[model samples]
Target: MSLDKGGKNMGRMKISVAAVFMCTFIISAVPASAGTSGRSVETTLQSDLAGSLNPEGLLLTVGGYRRWISGMNEEYGIPSSYVQSGAMLGVSPAYSHVSAHVEWKPVILAQVRLQYTLFRYFGDFGALLSFPSKDSPFGKDEVDAREGQEEKDWGQRYLLQPTLTAKAGPIIIRNQSDAAYFTYNGAGPYFLEWEYDTLVKDGGWVVSNRTFLLWEAWKGPGKAALLAGTVYEITRSFSADLTRRRIGAVAVWTPAEGDGLFQKPRIYSQVGVNLEDRNRDGEVYFIIGAGFDHDL
Candidate 1:
């Protein structure tokens, strides 16, 4: 199913209008009586360990998540919903003011990541390696029939990510950046004219940055809290000279806090607008997800 130029323009206009309406709705939904005292209980623990030089030994964690996204299709150029489970092994050696972890997500889209935190949580760095199995659901050849080209396998993917966080009172700020490189398995100059308008000879690079501003809306009643936030993201493809920008409103609900087997269960939703996108048909996107962690 392909849309003509005029039809695509109309769809984008409608999505823009819907984005404005959704943003207004999100703003209006914030409780007027929400107080600043709703800060997360973890803040206290963070402060206590801020400058401490005590080593916490090895901490192992297992977690799983499920997420759904609106506007998920090849034409939309967005990722599809999936269920993922993973386990992480970490060590925090406070003597050097650093922490490191390794995580693995197996099957379907197999991935392995190594991450390190430096300067007492002031800076975080990570590298991820991933490749999809034959059972992977992404980039099927059938989805590319309209383009008259067989979609090559995704091949291997490498990513480097860094993040920083800061907090003041009931507000928190975070910024994360990712640089990804992809390798194609077969074919000559794989070109995604619909999405990037460029040819991928052997590999390509895509970089993006996302920033978030969140405020605690309500907290209490046994470690439950509500948070509202806004996120802005910009992405660029070095191989294609393509750029994309997005802005969104988000809300998160933490049901409880504990260090037991399963802890810090959270549910979140977001309404987003593609401020600028040369690819895809829609301007508005919606996502809802939930996840929890297990300590072993």
Candidate 2:
């Protein structure tokens, strides 16, 4: 029935984009006035982790991310499935992580970005580590980072993101984490240019479930994008009402899967790499991905 009416309109567009991102994060978690946050519209607040994605400041990219959501059904903690959704949202797979900042857009729809996020669950990345700039970049360093102590076994929470993206038609949505629910939400890393991963434990090895949907477009014969989604396994995180479903159908043509590749059949290319995995029992789960966008 037209592919089950497009998975019931992608689960009502993931519950209306999670109810408009939880009603604009509960009205910016309330508390404004510094002249209404120095004239609101400051990318919706929270950014400046030593901002710099390179506009000839050098250091093209310095990104970090660790996404692990579990719940193949937690025995009785709550979340029915997917390693009990990260141990029933205690979330702390290496402190469930994300860190990135990028720069370089002197031209072409112009680019400039500042970012902040510490994942709201327990809260504290110091709002992307506030920086009013002395041309900051964690400069004037003392270097002291002692988070909630997590190497990984369990415990995690965070989804603050920032985003900015430009490229009309073909569609693109950038939100870039103001703690927006995991996995590098939106274009915080300047619509990013590199992402990688690999994980294969051994609960026997691979059961399975997954989902992802993406639509990104960048100009020129040099840039390309598209990742029509599916595969649903984003366990849980401080839920009152959050639901996602797909568990399959992550299509990628990558502009020609080979034999003299490209002339057509792309879904974002630069030697593509997109592999998503999910498991949560016996000890075998996954999220191995890869990305590298280019424009010289």
Candidate 3:
């Protein structure tokens, strides 16, 4: 996901204030998590929102997410899920505007995700686009604070996401990896490097991997099912030399077959802890959300 660029004084102040208010209210009103990126949490939620498999054709999803981490002041909440809609033709394309509020940080990211199946019921290749520096929201002080003393303005960002899935009896295993590239609004130009251990002077890359192991806990008579799973996530930022790791347990509930207003509904909850992190003070986190999709 991508955030919009920074604006002038008033605009920046307004966004900052709104973000603080939302974070405060959410903390008092709900639980919290550590310094996990809003995009990461949204990715997990979206995965669960798919229920058993990815939906086809036009689809819409609505839900809210909340997380809290122990040991730090950071907390994130989406009291209401942002605009999430997508469609799958031969190539699936989707868009989302995610508004995340933290104690001292507020970010709004707009992203388009395109995916094409590489093989039937196995794997796929995907790309994430946040284009036009003016429209994309990365490296903005109002949205994300600098991790170091140096100041820089980030421009467009892109990511290549590849996925793999396997199933055996009642268990399913899935893995998704992301390699991200960034552009900056400065003089220094950086070339793409496969070496994630090396730092770049200007733009850089972030790599992440997420894996899930799910078990079919229960099944209803119709199209309803309950799944329990464990998720492992690791993210590394080459520019900032930041690394985050988390492990959690999740449960998802899918409703029975129906053509009602809810369509294909999914309710999910997760609770996890940071196994290793140097960014945020928190250690544990919790998430609960519900969403439904409709085919066009």
Candidate 4:
């Protein structure tokens, strides 16, 4: 994470937020465990690609994702299923959850922006933005405000994402550093680490190879669990190895994943490079997936 390098207090905010949301979910979800005490595992794979002919002009992009989550209700000894379409909407330009943004484009490839998002499930809202920096990679930078539910945190949160991107012929390279902070009742300067994505694209073949790095800080809900043993172990173990870094690639065959069920889906795959508490790690966590992309 970029921490305080950008003057954004994001790193401090994420910590406090994590504590709050972890407790909230445990309190709310655990009680329903009656007749549901079991264990669960979930995994998801998705793909997306977008480009601007001008690179510095208005951008159009679309992508699709599919996720499968299943867990056991430790108390009731039953299984549970979870799926999120919000992940799809977040990256969708037309249907983005962003309520509004105040923006500035100082140069063709540089922009400054203030963005806000509302999470219906958590009843939380976020205020975020991005700024054009002289030292930025490709001259791009972003800052954001997220609510408790945005990242499953406790309450209000702030984030700073400093990004650098380079273009070499048909390949594009990008690196981003992310940090966040969380505050509740004006009580914290607590810091928490977060997520990032690295991508390498080949314009010539309309293909891309990418990786996603994500993690969770252990604190507030570290000890809370709905199940006594295995279920709790599953959650704790997963959370402890909270750092999730995935590497994958995709190849676009036609134009998109298809218009309907009769059409073909886009192909994508990913392997977990570093997994927490794993003896047979790296590449052991692999997923093959299909999705769609459209220009809007």
For each candidate in turn, the TM-score is 0.50, 0.19, 0.47, 0.29
Tens-place lDDT digits, model 3, residues 132-194: 232222222322242222222323445555445555656756666667665544333332111
Query: How well is each residue in 139-201 modelled by candidate 2, as lDDT tens digits?
Result: 111111322221122112232233233323443222332232223222122110011011111
lDDT of 3: 0.38
Instruction: Give the alpha carbon lDDT tens digit for every residue of 194-293 in model 4.
Output: 1111111111011111222211111122222221100001111111122223333222122222344423233322223333222223433322323332
Q: What is the lDDT of residue 162 in candidate 2?
A: 32
- Better by lDDT, candidate 4 or 2: 4
Error of 4 at 241 (Å): 13
State the lDDT of candidate 1 residue by residue for 239-270, as single tens digits: 65667687888887767567764454555566
Q: What are the runs in model 2 whose C-alpha is more than 4 Å off? A: 1-230, 235-241, 256-265, 268-292
Q: Count the backbone clashes (under 3 Å) in each candidate.
A: 0, 47, 11, 35
lDDT for position 229 in model 4:
9
Global lDDT scores for all candidate models: 0.39, 0.22, 0.38, 0.25
Report residue 25 deviation for candidate 3 (angstroms). 31
Sort the candidates on lDDT, descending order. Answer: 1, 3, 4, 2
RMSD of each: 18.1, 23.6, 17.9, 21.8
